[model samples]
Target: MNRSADIMILDLSESSAYKTNLKHIDFCGSPVINKDHWLYWGSRVLSTSEASTSNVLMRVAEQTEFLDDETFETIAGCSKSENYSQRCSRTSLQSRDKLMYIQKEQLGLESEFPQHLLPDGKFNVDGFILACDVSKETVLHSNHVINIAKSIAKTKKPIVIAFTKCDEMSEECKRHYMTLFLATKELKHVLCNLPPVETSAVKNVNVEYLFGSLAMLCLRSQKLVKKPPLAYHEASLFVEQRNLHVKCCFSTLLSQAVPLCVYPKKFLSWKQVLADIDRHPDLMNFVEVFGSRVAFEMYERYVSEAKELWAMNRLRSHVPRLFEVFQVFLGVVDLADMEWNMARDYMRCHPLFSVLFENNDYDLGMWSPSTFNVDEKSRLPAEILLLPEAGNVFEQFRVGRSDGVVAIVNGK
Candidate 1:
C-alpha cells in the first residue's frame, strides 16, 4: 500500500489527452485525472520527484474512481478534434503514463490531508486543482468550473487556479484576465484575513501559487498537532488593523457625502438620502457609515431638516466620532459653533440657493450690490443697532430690516 500515491493530476490540456487515457492501463489504486481537467486525488508527501516517461512511479495507493470508458472516449475525441495541433499522441502507453504521472505530481498536494479521514468516512485529498479551458465563455461552463473547484476546496484542500489559452488571449482579453487576476488576489487576501478557508478557486493566474499553498496546508493537516493560539497582543494587533480598515472605508464614504442640492430648499428627505447613499460607488463604505442603527437614525433626522440636512447630519455624526477616536478637539470650546458656521457658509455658497429661494418672498438684496450698495449713505439707518451680545447678528439683521432706513440725528 503506497500512501504517497494518493495524489493525482487531471490535465485537460490538448497535450494531456493521450496521457489521461493511460489511467485505464493499470490499477494504480491512486487518483485518476478526469475529463474536467481536475486532479481528483490525494498526496502524502510535501514534494515528490518529477514523474518521467522512463521511470513511471505510482504516487498514491488508493483506488481511483473514474467515469465509464464511453465518457472518457468522448472527451478524448473532443480534445483531439478541438485542439488538433496540441493534441497528445495516442500511439504509446508507457510514455503516456509517465507523462501523465509527472504532470500530476508537479502540483504538490502533501499538505492537504490528515494522516487519514477523520474517523468519519470522508474522502480527503490534500487539495486538488480543477483546471478549465479559457476558450469556453458560457456562464454554464464557468459555473461548472466554479462548482468543481468548490467541491475540491471543501475537502479542506487549497485549490490552484489554472487556465488554458494563455498564448492566444487578445490584449482586451488579457486586460480582462488581469482584472480577474486582481479579483483573485483580492479574494485570497480576504480569505486569509478572515477566519480561513472562506474562499478558494481554480483559474489561470496564481494557479501554481495556490497549488503550493494547498500542499503546505494538507501537510499541516496531516500532522494533527494543533498550532498554538495567538498571543493576546497579536490578537489585539489583528483587531486594530481590522478597525483601521473599517475606518478607512468610513473616511471614503465621508469624502463622497457631499451635498447634491437636488431637492427643494436643499432639503433631502430620508428616502432621498437613503437612495443617494445607496447609489454610492463604494457601497461597502456607505454601509460602514450609514448601515448601522445609529447612523440610520442620524440619516433620518438629517433628511427631515429644511436644507441639505443629510450633509449636515453626516458632518455632525462624523465629527463626534472623529473627535472621540482622535481626540482632535477635546479642549476646543467653540467646536460646535465652528461646525455650524462651516455648514452655514457651505449653504450660503451653494449654487442650489438660487433655486431654493427662487419662490420665497424674502430678498437676498443685502448680499447684492444692485439692490443695496455699501457706498450709498442714504440706505444707512440711525441708531446703529448692535446684536445684544448673545444671539446671531445675521438672524437679527434678517428680522429687523424694512424696505429702507433713514438717518435720525444731525451729523457733522
Candidate 2:
C-alpha cells in the first residue's frame, strides 16, 4: 500500500456527523480509515460512577466493552442525511468542556489499539485530519481537543484542524472561528504548530483545498537527507605562496591577519574547545573571524590529530571517548553554540573523515597585514582564509565573529 496516500481522520470531537464529514473530505480515491473508539460509548470507559451522574456522558461512556467493537458504529450506520443529524446533544460549550476533562482523565485507561489499525501493513498514516464541526460552540480550548492533540505529539505528524459545517456558519461566526484557530498557537505546546483550515463537505466549500493541502503537506514532510560535509583530506587545498586575490574581513586594531594570529593553543580536543570557548578571551573572537565551520574543522582536525599522535605514541587506550561525548553534546547543545559544535556532528555526515588528521589538507602559512603593507596597528583580516581549487568554481570561504559565516564561492 502507498503509505503516502493513507490519511487518518481523528473524530475526537465525537461528532455524530463524523462519517458524513469523512466521506465528504475526499482523498482522491485513496483509502480513508475511520476510528470509532471516540464516537461510540462503550465499556472501556473512564469512570462509570462519574459518567452515571451525567446522562449525556453516561451514554457516551457506555460505547463498547472493547473500543474496537463498534456497537454505535459510524462507518456502517451513517448512510443517510438523517443519520448525520442523529448525534449526541453534547455539542454545547459546557458539555464539550466536561467531555474534554473525561477524555484527559481517561487517557491511558483505554486501548490505543485503534490508533495502530492502519489500512494495511505497507501503508503508514501521512497526516491526521482533526474533524470538528464549526457549528459547535467549543473549540481548541476544550480538554478533548488538547488530549487528542497531545496523544499524537510524539508522532511528529502534521495536524490539520478541519472546521466542518462551514456552510452553516455566518461571516461573523467564520471570523470568530478563524480568530480562535489563530489564537490556539498561544495555548502552548500542542496546537502551536497545527494549522486550522475551514472545510465543508456538504457545500464542497474547501473540500478540494483540504485534501490538496494534505497532499502538499505530505510531500513537504518527506525531507531529503543532507549531503555530507566536505572532507578535509578530499577537499582541494590552496596554500598561499604566489600573490592570490581574496576577500576577507579585517580589523586594523589587532594589526595581525585574524586567522593566522588567533589560535586556541591550550585547547586540544572537543572537550577543551567547548569548555574554554566561553571563557577564552581570544578564542571566540578568533572563531568569529575565521567562520565557525572552518574553526570547527580546525578543532576537529586538532582532536583527530591528537588522537593519532596518542595512538602513535602507543597511548591509544589513554585517548578519551571524545567522539561519543561529542555526539551527545551535538544532540543537546543549544543553537546559540551550534556553530562551534560542528565537529560533534561531523561523524553522522562524514563518517570516514570523522577520525585521524592530515597535514597536507590545510595551509599552515602565517598571514600578516605587513605582507599587504598595511601600517594600521594590530590589523586583522576578517576573511582570514580561502581555499581555491583548480577547475571547480566552488571555493570554501570562512569569516569569523560570534555569529560565524561559511560560504562556497561558485566563481571569482
Candidate 3:
C-alpha cells in the first residue's frame, strides 16, 4: 500500500463501532478498515472523488456531536443546502445517543459523558501534577497537600514534594529531612506507588528539575503518536537563566548597601532580600525607581535593618496589633473613624512606638508621622525617610525645660 495515497479520513458515525469509538478520524488510515464498515477517502478512491463536495462535507460533519442550541445553529448555518447540514447535524445527534447506548451496554458510562471537549477544540488529557510544600511547622500542612495530591493522583501523574528552607537545618536537624523523606516514601507506597516521587526546594534547590521531569513524561507520551513534546529543555533553560539574572541583580544591590547600624553582622543578604520581593511579585513595579543598582542596594539595607530590629527588640510580639493599624495605613484593611479610635486604643496599650524608637532617636517632627503622606505617596517605604546625620554623636543627656516667668506674685 502506498502510504501517501493511502491516507484516509474515516467517518465512523455510520459504523457499528460508532457508539464506542472515541478516537479522532485522522487515526484511521486510507480506505480505513474497521470491523463494522470501511470508508475510503484517499485520492485513489474514485467513488470518494465522484461524490459531491456537499456530500463529502456532510459525511465529515457527521462525526462530531453538537449538544447546545448555539452549536446546532452554527452547524446549520455551515451546512450546504444540497448536503443539508441539518440532516448531518441530526445524524450527529442520533449517533451521539447511539454511542451512549453502546457505552451503557459495554463500557458502562451509563448516563453521562465522562469525556468532554475543551473550548480550544481538544480532548482533555487526564493528568495532574502534585505540588507539595514541606517546611518546619508545615508538616501537618502535608496532610492537606496529600489530600489534594491524592485527588490529582487519579489523573495519573507523578507527585512531588517541594521542601522549602532546608538550608536553615543543622546537622542534628538533618533527621527531620530523613523523616520527611520516609514519610513521602511511605505515602507513595500506600497510595498510587506508580511513579517515583521527586523532592525540591527553592534554596539549595533544582527548582526546574521536577518540572523538567514532568515535561519529559508528557513529551514521551506525545511521541507515541508523533506529537511534539509539551515542554522542552529550552524552556527550562530560559527559567534558569531568568532566575540567575535576578539573583545577580539582587547580589549587586546588597554589596553597595551600608551595614546595619544596630546589627552590623546581621546585615541583609541578597538571597533574603530577593526572597521578600519574590514572594510578592506585586512589589516589582517599585523596584524600577531605585534603578536596578540602587534598588537592590536600598532593598538590602531596608530589609536587613528591619529584620535585625525586629529580632533584637522582639518587635514581632507587637506585630499582630501593629499589623491591624499598618494594614489600614497600607490600605489593605479598612475601618471607620470609630475603628481607628479602637485601633489607637489598642496601640496605646502596647509599647509600640517606644519599642520601635528604642535605639533610634530621629526627630519625629522632621519625619513624616503618618505612614501615608499625600506628597510621597508614590515613593517606597525606605525612600520616604531622611537619612540620619552622618557621624553626629549626641550627648546622653536630655535638655532641661525652661519657662518664661514674671516676678513672683507676692513680690509683684
Candidate 4:
C-alpha cells in the first residue's frame, strides 16, 4: 500500500470470478481450445469505468471455464481413445497453452507463478496488500484472495487485507466481513483475529492507516533481518522478559547441553545398527559407536568429562537404542532444509522423542563395564519398534516447527 509501490495488475478476461468486473462480459463468443476448460486472461490495468474504487487491484482465478464445440469434440475424442493418457500427453506436447489449461484443473496454475516465475531468492516483496470490495459480489472472491495470498507467500509475506468501498457497506455487509475474518483466523499469513482495515479513498477514511500499516510491516520485517542472533544466556533472558517461565526455558536449554553418545559415521542401515547393538551388549561402546551423530557432533565440542557423561546419559535415557537414534537422525536429515534454530527446538520438543523414551519398558542406563543382564538382552529384539508409526507421527513436526518454537518460547 506504499505510495510508490510497484503494482502489477493482471486482467483475467476469461476468469469466471472476474467476468462481472469487466465492462462487456462476453464468454459465449470466445472460442474454446479444449473441452475440459478454456480461460483467456492477460495482464492489464483495470479501466476507470471498471475500477469503482481507488483501492489497489487484486485477482482470484477459478479453474472452471467453458469450451467450444470443436474443442469439446477434440477432447472427447482424446478421452474415448484406448490410450487416453497418451493422447492427452501428445496434445499437451503439441500445444503448450492447451496443456497449461488442462493442468489448471488438477494442479493450480498459481503454483507455477511461485515455483517458476518467482523462484526463491530472486524476489522479496516487503508485504502483500490484498484489496477487496466488501459486498456480496466479492464475498467469495475475498476468501479466494486470502487463500491465494497464503499460497503465494507461504508465511514469507505478511498479508494486510484492505476492505475497499467500506463507505458503501450496509449493516449486513459489515456482519459478513466479521464472519469471514473469523472463519479464516486459522490461515497462516492472515493476522489472527485482526479485522481487515475498512478503507475508502472516496470518503478518505482509514486510508492513511492502511498505508501506514504497510510501512510499519516493512520496517518490522527489516528489523528481523538486521537483528543479530541471541546468545544462549541472552536467549534465556529474552524468554524471561516475554513472561515465560525462566526455569522451564533454562531446563530446555540444559536439555540441549546434555550430551548424547556419539554415533558412527557410516551406517550399514537400521537393521545393521540394531543387529550390532544386539551382538555387542556393551552399552558404552554401543552408544559411543551407534548413537546420534548429531549428538556425537555436539559431544566433540565439550571439554568437560561431567558434561560429556551428562550428554551420554541423556542419550541413553531419551534415545537409548540404535534403531531409535537412527530414526531420529533420519528425521533430522529429512528436515535439513529448515532453519537450524527452528529445527533443533523441534528435535527437542517433538512428541516422537517422548514416545521413543516412554513407550518401552527398557531404559539403558549410564554405560559401565561390569553390567550384564541376559533377560533384558533376550527381550530387546522381540520388543516391537514401530518405525513407520514414528515416521507418521512426526510427519507434520517439521512443518509445525513454528508453532513448536512459540510453545517453547512461551514455556508451554
Candidate 5:
C-alpha cells in the first residue's frame, strides 16, 4: 500500500467532537472496519468506490436497533440526495490517538488498523480531516481546532473541516454554526475558498462530499512531490528510517526518590550521573518495556551520528526511542512489504505508549535554558562540577528545579 496516500482525521477528542469518530467511520465506507466488532447498528455498508449510496447508511440508520421505526423513516428520507456517494466510497478510515487516517489513493487500505508515529515523529500519511461535533458550542470551540488545521496547511498538507452530526441539527442550526465556524480567523485564512462538508453519519448526509473532496485535495497536494523515484541505496535508507518513535511517560509519585543532582553528588561523574539517571525509578520504567539497551540509548548517549544516514529525515525532534526505531522507512523502486509492522506493533503495544500519537510535547527534565546560555543564573543552571559536592555554595546557588527530586514523566 502507498502509506503516503493515507489521510489523517485528527481525533481531537477534547475538541468537542463528542466521540463522533466511530459513527463517522461507520458512515464512510467502514461500517465493517473491524470484523470483530460493529461500531454501532450498521448491517451492511456501501463501499466508497461504489456508484450509488442511497440506501447505504440509510440502511444502517434504519437498522439502528435503538431507534423507533418512525425515526428511521425520518432519517432514511434525508439520504436521497447527497448527489455523490461515490466520493465517500473511494476512501477508508482508522483512528489512533488524536489521529484517524483515511485512505484515498490506497482506497482499499485496511479500514481499521494500528498506526505508528514514524521515527521522525510524524504520521506516515498525507492530508487531514478536522472533525467537530455539530453544536453551537463545539462550533465555537473548533476555532482552536482550526488553528491546528492552519499549521497542517502551512506544512503544505491538504486538510478539510468535517462538521459531524449535522443529522441532529435543524437547517437553521446548521447554517448558524457554519456561519460562526467559517468566520473563524484561521478558518478564513487557511480554508480560503473551500467550504466545510456538514456530515451526518446517521442520515448519510453529504458523506460523499466530505471525503471525496479530501481525496481530491490530497491527490492535488502530492503533485508538488511528483519527481522521479529515489536511487537504490536511497530507497534502502528510506525503509530503514520508517521506524516508529516511542515515548514512555511516568505518572507515579516519586516524591520520596530524588531526581535532581543539581546539589551534586560527592562522587557524581558525567557518565555516573547518567547511569544514576538510567536507574531512576521513573526512567527505569522504560527499561522494563524497551529494555536496558534502550535505556542506554535514551539516557547514556550523546548525539546520534546515524540520524543523517538518510536524506530529508522526517524526525525533526528527538524522542526516547530514536535509535531502535532507525531500522526503517527508506523509499524503494518497488513498494514491497517490510517486517516493519511487527516491530511497530510491539513498540506501540507498550502500556506506557498510551499517548503515542498525542500531539503533546513531553519534557522528561532533559532540557534547560542552561544548555543554551553560558551564564550561571539562566533558567537552568549548568553543572559546573564533574562531581558535585553538597558543601559547594556555587552549586547551591545555581540550583534549578526539574521534574522533581522524584517525579513521573511522559505517562509511564
Candidate 6:
C-alpha cells in the first residue's frame, strides 16, 4: 500500500487470491435516514486500506464525513440529468474511519459511443458492451456474442478488444491486458498519442485519439469531437459520449462511430426518443445494437414516469414502477408518491433489476434457471481460429480489406 497525493492508497492488485494480513471483529452499521437494512460489515482493511492508485471507490476526504442522503449531492439550478448529485450514490454508505465499504448496486446505466460518428450521420463500426459480474464465482458471456463476433471476423473487418473492470483486476492481469492491447498495431498508436491517466466518469472530459487510424480505415474517422452532433463540424466525425460513468476511458477508442442524434440536442429528449423508437419501424435497427440508448431511455423514463404512475384508474407501467415499488417500499417517504407501495422489498438492487426486466438473463424467480451457460466457451466462433493455416503467406492475400471496426468489451 502506498500514498498517492494526500490519500493513502491500498494496493489490492496482487495476482494471488486474498491472503489475510489479519481479520478484525465484524460489526453492524445503520443509516441516518432511519432505514430498514443494516450493514453487517467485516473489516477488510487492517494496516492500511486496500486501495488502487486509480481507485475512485474510496475517497479519504469524502469518507471523513457521514452522509445519509443524496442531500449533499445537490446542485444549485440544474436538471436531474446535469446534476452532479447523480454521481453520488444514495444506498451506499461511507464510514468516517474507512474500515468498511458498501458494495455498489447497478444504477441501470450504460455508456456507449455515438451511433452517428461522422457529420453525414452514417455509422460504420459495430459496438458492443458485454458484461460479467466479477463478484460471481465464474464470468459468463453469451454464445450469441461469439456468433456475432465470428460473423464480423469472417468479413475481414477490424476488431478491437478492451477489458474493463480494472479496479477489481489484479495488477498482473492489468499488465497482461495492457501488453496485449499495446501489441496490437492500432491500439499501440492510441496509447502512445494519449497520456495514461484516470479520473471519475462523471467529469465527461474528451481527448480525440482513438486508433486515429480509425479514420484511415474509414474515410470518415477524420477530425472529430466528443461533443454532440450540433457541435459537429462539416464532414467530421461527431459522437457525444453521453452520461456513462465509466465511458470516459473506453468511448474514445472507437474512431468510426455513429452519433445517437438524441442527446446534447436541446430539442430531443429521452421521452421523444423512446416514443420514436416505439412508433417507427425504420429506426428499429437504427444502429446495430441499441442497448446503451435503450438503457439511458429506460432509466430516464423509469425515474420520470414513476412520478405519475399512480393515475386514478390505469394499469401501471410495469418496468418503471416495479423498480420504484421494489426499492422505495421499505422507506417511510415516497409513499404518497408511490402507487400502492407496500412491498417488504429489502432485496438487493441487482435481483430487483432482473425481475423488472424479466426477459434479461438475471432471474431470481428461479423460473428462468439458465441466465448464462458456462459451456459456451467450448464453442470458439472466430473464423481465424478454425480456418487459418499454420504459416500460409497466401492466406494474407486471400483476406478482405477491413470494412468496419467492431469492439466487444466486458462491462464488469
- Tens-place lDDT per residue, model 2, 229-293, is 22211221221111011112112212132222223223234554456444443544445434557
Clashing pairs in 3: 8-30, 19-99
**Candidate 4, superposed: residue stretches over 4 Å from native:** 1-124, 136-146, 153-155, 185-189, 192-194, 221-412
Q: Which regions in candidate 6 have their CA more than 4 angstroms from the true location?
A: 1-168, 177-213, 216-241, 244-412
TM-score of 5: 0.28
Q: Quick one: best lDDT, which candidate?
A: 4
lDDT of 3 by residue, 1-412 (tens): 1111111111211212122322322112211211112122112211122122111111111122222233322122122242221221121111111221122222233234443211232112212233322223322433433344444444343333333333343333334434543665334632332232223343324433433433333333222222222232343455456656665665444444433443444544566656645634323533532245656565655665555453433322222232223323323222332333453444335544343323343333223223213232222222111212100100000010012221221231
Could you tell me which 10 consecutive residues in candidate 2 have the lowest summed lDDT? 57-66
Model 2 has how many clashing residue pairs? Answer: 25
TM-score per model over all chains: 0.24, 0.28, 0.23, 0.26, 0.28, 0.19
C-alpha RMSD in Å of predicted model 2 compared with the true structure:
25.5
Roughly what TM-score does model 1 have, to 2 decimal places? 0.24
Give RMSD to native, each candidate. 22.5, 25.5, 22.0, 27.1, 27.8, 32.6
Q: Which rank order by lDDT, best down to worst?
A: 4, 5, 2, 1, 3, 6
Tens digit of per-residue lDDT, candidate 1, span 1-412:
2222123233332233223343432323332232322232323333323232121112321222233344554233213243321221111111112112234433234234222221122233443433334443333323322333334444444433444443333334334433543444323532342211111121123322334444444444322212322332354455457646765665455334534344232444446555767755455544543356645564544333423333332223222122121122222222333433453444346554343223233222332323322332222211111112112432222232221321121120
**Error at 407, model 2, angstroms:** 99
lDDT of 5 by residue, 1-412 (tens): 1212345555332332322223323334432222111121212222334232222221110011111133322112122232111112213323222222333222134434544222232223455666655544333544444455555555566666766665464455456556755666555643553555666555445555565555545555323222323332343344334312223342121211223322212223346645545556665554544555664564323222212211112122222122212212111112133233343344346543333332234232323223222232222111211112211321222221121221112331
Off by over 4 Å in 5: 1-4, 11-123, 135-139, 170-177, 189-193, 221-412
The lDDT of each candidate is 0.33, 0.35, 0.31, 0.36, 0.36, 0.26
lDDT preference between candidates 1 and 5, better one = 5
Name the runs in model 1 displaced over 4 angstroms.
1-124, 135-140, 169-211, 221-412
